[model samples]
Target: MVDWAAYTLVFVAGLITALATGIGALPFFFVPDISEKFNVGLWGVASGIMMAASIFGLIPEGLNAGPWTTVAVGLVAGGLLVLVANDLLMDADIDSRTYEEADFKKLVLILGVLTVHSFPEGIAIGVSFAELNLGSGIPLLGFTVPALAIAMTIAISIHNIPEGVAISIPLRTMGVAEWKMVWWSIFSSLPQPLGAVIAFGFVQLAEPLLPAGFGFAAGAMIYLVLSEFIPDALEAGEELDGKGYRELVAGFAAGGGAMVLLLVVV
Candidate 1:
């Protein structure tokens, strides 16, 4: 019963969300060096935005699709998927060191590892496009555009800034050119658009599963933040002699609080 055209439009919206991550990297081309402190702040802002999107956007949407049981199952499945991926891709030896000394093969390995974390973000963007039209009668590019789509796109784009900085850090240490750093950062996030499109298409085809889709994306993202983002922040902050840990905690709280405020106001 789903309209293919509408579905395709949603998929395209997802693709745009993913591609926006690439835009975050473009800044590195112009800046001589991005400070670590600045990167940390960026990450904090990204963390806040994503948490807000998940809480305000994804969870409520999921609950609308079905009973609590459905959302619960999707959440568990999403978290499990990430856990399996982490176990499979993450090796302490490889992750313990920075990417500077890594050879070409090692770089590929790092990319693979990073993909596990980034793919969920793309999925979140894709899932948010499910309500592309809601009740709107207006058409956009032959399909109705949902307010949720615009919000998700903006949220995902904002989230990518910190991720771009994270990608650039290793490249900077490797003495990669500024522009190249931007390229690589963007390259790492290419999967986002692809993931978004696929997610949007899937949700359209299986409309009844929309709630599960939302939960799945939310679960993956929330788990990633708790498992990956927080830990990484802590590790990066370790150089600050205890001050880093404080900053990490403070940043997390600030980011989460900001998202809460945004949800209230917008």
Candidate 2:
């Protein structure tokens, strides 16, 4: 009874997002360094895409599938999970710098941190595809892909590019090779496929929970955009006169517009 084929498609979608992180490191092969302003803009762009996807894509989908109350509960639960994970890992924080001298235990700790950060994104992709083979959707390559699924996959892929850049910066400064930088960036998000498959399976089995799944993914992403993404952009943009708010806003508009355009086309 298991739709292994559909699951395979979902995993592939998640894998695509994870691989997208590598794109960030490709520029390093040609340039000595990326501008801080550009990095800030990337973060802003990521935040904008995530926020738009959550608010316009996920939340509405959740409402359409089930009651608003259930969706609210899911939102809270999703936000809480992120908050608690951060709190738990607050002291366990390790960075690219930590790896050079890290032991096996330390390496495991680093991976755990990366997994926590990237897992929700995978979940969002999975939740978006909950109706993958169950209902009417865009047909492609013999699969009924939800429009939201395509949108989330694209959104998450774009979002991960900045994350890849962030991961690569420290490695680049550490004299790591460009190819290794790309590899490490991809590794940071490697847990995505697992998260995607698990979430997709859960929603497909428990149909009633579909809406909550949508809300959970949306809530976690939106919270991350606010609490982490925007602040990061601001921090990186400090040298920009009058702050990098302008660049940040511009990036946001562009990212959001891209999502809107994709949705319209799909």
Candidate 3:
């Protein structure tokens, strides 16, 4: 028997994290020009929060589960899933020119790509809720919530800011209304709640697999930070400043250090 209430709460948490990305789009509403420096900084913050959450929250939870082999396998599987999705999307010849210029088919393609991009984030949120009243000791909404749930929620929300900005930049150029940008950004992340519910259900059904769930989320996120987010930040910064590499390195170090400190303290 599944605990419906716990699943609902986890879904809500994931939804809230997804919605927080909308906040990043809000800046475009007032500020016509968003500085490149600001974008880099936002990425830095996102990276920091994600790393902190993965290390302090997800990995630790995974360790609580049985053998290391389970976690290792889950991590590799999660990363491979993202890679496969990326390959499929990249192979498709979807135009990335303009949102308005894109036909319905192109829009669908874009959404598909976005889904691959966002799924792991949703999974992280979902897996974090594994301990929902099952054992862990944090309390929320009349149930004993896992601390990892709270941490993942906060981490994902912070990480989404840069993503929202990335989405808004294109929409802005396409002359999409600011509010519409916010809506679309939120729309891009809509899968999170569904992911959360599914993951929570899985954990509830297979309690023993909870640790693997944690490792899956953590591995996916850490891989993203290393492979995609950091590289994107550096490239973006390079285009803006001749010494972009320096800035990228500084930002990465600072972000990673901050996350480490947070983990240590919290």
Task: Give the number of the best model, judged by lDDT.
Answer: 2
- What TM-score would you give candidate 1 relative to the actual structure? 0.63
Q: Arrange candidates by lDDT, descending.
A: 2, 3, 1
lDDT of 2 by residue, 13-68 (tens): 99999999899789889977658777666666666766776787768867987899
**Deviation from native of the Cα of residue 258 in model 3, angstroms:** 5.1
Candidates, ranked, TM-score: 2, 1, 3
Give residue 63's error in model 2 in angstroms: 2.3
Whole-model Cα lDDT of every candidate shown, in order: 0.61, 0.73, 0.67
Greater-TM-score candidate between 1 and 2: 2
Per-prediction TM-score to the true structure, in the order listed: 0.63, 0.64, 0.61
Q: What does candidate 1's lDDT look like per residue over 120-184, in tens digits?
A: 55666667666666777446675666766677677766656555655554455455677776667
Q: In model 3, which residue pairs have backbone atoms overlapping below 3 Å?
A: none
lDDT (tens digit, per residue) of candidate 3 on 1-266? 86777777888898997898798789887877646676565556556655666677667757776577887877776576556655665566666565433333333433443444465567667777776678867777799877878987987787666557656654554467889889888888888888778767775554566667667766666666665556666766776765365555565566667666655654
Q: How many backbone clashes does candidate 2 have?
A: 0
